[model samples]
Target: MAQPRKMLLVDDNDESRYQLQTLLEFAGEKVVTRTCEKTITNIEDNLFALVINANSLGDYSLETITEKYPHTPIILVDSNKNHPLIQQQHDWRVIGSLALPLKYPDMMALIRKCESFKPEDLPSQTINSGNTEVLFKKLVGKTPEITKVRENILQLTDSDVNVLITGESGSGKEMVAKNIHYLSKRSNNKFVAVNCGAIPSELLESELFGHEKGAFTGAMTKRLGRFEVAQGGTLFLDEIGDMPLPMQVKLLRVLEDRTYERVGSNTPIKADVRVIAATHCNLRKAILEGRFREDLYYRLNVFPIEIPPLRARKEDIPLIVQNLLQTLEARHKKKIRLSSTALKALNDYDWPGNIRELSNLLERLTVEFSNQLIDAAEISQKLKQQGRITPSRIPEARLPEGDFDLKELLSNLEANYIKLALEESDGTVSRAAQRLGLGRTTLVEKMRKYQIDRDDISETDS
Candidate 1:
């Protein structure tokens, strides 16, 4: 049995407010009715589970309410769904809007949905003193590799240069882009993200630059594009390598001129947006294969940052697990713990899907083993079910009879053995080094010299 949620219903119209208040009270909710003029004065004294606003706060901007209670969820009541205020509402706190004279079913459904709104799900706007650690609090790692990434993000905070982030899928490229955006000079504006690979090629241009009301067959109304929406902020172009060649040319032009026009309009609009592009593909290789343009690559790759996959930073697994479990507990309202052996099993397996895979596994565990200690055997069973477990085999060095470089052969053999040891030890440098009879620092040096990384080995295995 849970207590009734306290809801503040703000409506200027006396009849409408009374009707809504009576309905809410009938449903056993604690309803506090207030006119727009009096709501602000009383909003500070008590915490509210939800604020139902009729968008009729004369002279009082909703921005003030949102700014004051950033974590509180809001439900907008408007006669028109396409009203400029409702359409332009960019605050993430507003869960949904309803037409005036709301139906009982819709209102009840929305109330049910609001019950799941956890404060941790909201994105934080505060960046304390431009600290990279604070800006990247969600990054969840202490490894040197991730530390370098934070440092790179810190360096880019002051500049609006086009950043190209390259990494494997689920390596948190979008997360990196977001950290850069929140830490940059444009932190106060919207951070728009568009996936180049997800959108159809035909609609991608209009999606990026917007379209006129009659631009195409399905263009029923004029819509703001990602560029217009992200004005004075950052536009994150994820998986840019998958953008078509024609769109690439257009994007390059926009990058060069900082201007673009809607699909069916000739008026040029100045783009004051910063662009951050990310891709998992090798753009250089794509260029060689004629799948990508060389000039476009250079335009977006002005300040390149590559994120190492999760396997490369296995030492961060425990911290990541802890961070993820906190989020799970907040969302599910249930606590779950992993035994030391279970944690060790996770660190011993290669996370091919990286952080996203780890997060999914944690969620699954919460569903199946809530409020319980998960052990190594259970973790192994799940990994086996996912077909992620495979036996490691040692590589044998072969001598070539023809004209082969002895130095290159020995280097190849050493790299192979290192890769094998890393696979067997699940990428713990200390464990892998011990298995290879080499010091940790020595193993690291060899890995650097050979340009061998966990991502490289993961690619080989795949």
Candidate 2:
């Protein structure tokens, strides 16, 4: 004879609560129904196997309940799982949502899913697979688009090849570069990151190659450039495409000659550090326009890695939300959850700001909606205010609602179709091409014409 599993059914609706309790009892499970927080809070540990909240359980916070009883399975019963408010609570890893007049088979499935739940199954989990640290876990994604990025990161470590990571602002170019430095043989040495665009053109040379005490009027003391500071390590040049034309010539010299001189010093310094550059601009286009050096472009583009935008890899949103929530919760000591509707809204909208924007939004939401469920409506409002989410991509069909030009409309429809295929196919160009009934080369050409990034299509070379 097996011992009966304890289940707590919470519902403010008396009739609904009684019905659920009776159903559980009829199903041969030991059941307890409670409507108040105090009642459930007082229940001893190792007592309940599951906690089911019907509709909204007033004060008995689901976040608190899940955290306090991590082992106990918590299910939020709702009419619609996609409800913005309901979807917000998925972060707690609820044992699936139960619909009204829930079926017995669904209950059994939840029980089985709960039993199989492991902490490591979450994207926020810190994993140790042999000696190599899984740094990309925090990057938090399982899609092939993101998985390919991880594969590239791993490959980057075995060699000291100069890497050029191209991605939109806030898409985590520097973070990826940081991971490369930490995972490299030069991990012990200094890892210096410089933003070429942020520094003025006049001071840019001094910043990269350093300056002697008498190099300039402001140079009262000897300064070590980023290259010298990063000796025997790695130097991350952010927004490298923004470097001035003259600086590009100097940079090209350093790359080819493996040496540089300080602003006032004639003696050249041997730069043993590895270079990893990143930019949001189209470097090839920049080269053609004479804004960026063509020679420097080839030197830095030796091993290119382009990060996919958040909208392009919407599959990564849930994992990213989970990972961000884990840290935000631990820091704030408050639980923040996103409803499935909210998640979908976030995933549906085009993220112009990428991961950095997503992270900032999560942080803001964490504080604003502390311990409260965030619905799709709130997410929509917030996204609108930030001008981060675009409504054009929301519809399942690729048709535009309000449009003037047939040519423009058709182009948008085609682009939307391609975007959907790439997303559905997990950014694999070949797979997306197959789905679109186009040759791989033809799709690649179209993507180029449309200015669709390779990462947005798929990180794979295919």
Model 2 clash tally, residue pairs: 7
Candidate that scores best on lDDT? 1
TM-score of each: 0.61, 0.57
Spell out the clash pairs found in candidate 2: 84-375, 84-376, 87-338, 87-339, 87-340, 88-338, 88-339
| TM-score of candidate 1 relative to the true fold | 0.61
Best by TM-score: 1
lDDT of 2: 0.72
lDDT: worst 10-residue window of model 2: 453-462
List the lowest-lDDT window of 10 residues for candidate 1. Answer: 124-133
Model-by-model lDDT, in order?
0.77, 0.72
Taking all chains together, the TM-score of candidate 2 against the true structure is 0.57
**lDDT of candidate 2 at residue 381, scale 0 to 100:** 82
lDDT of 2 by residue, 144-175 (tens): 77777777887876699999998876677887
Clash totals for all candidate models: 0, 7
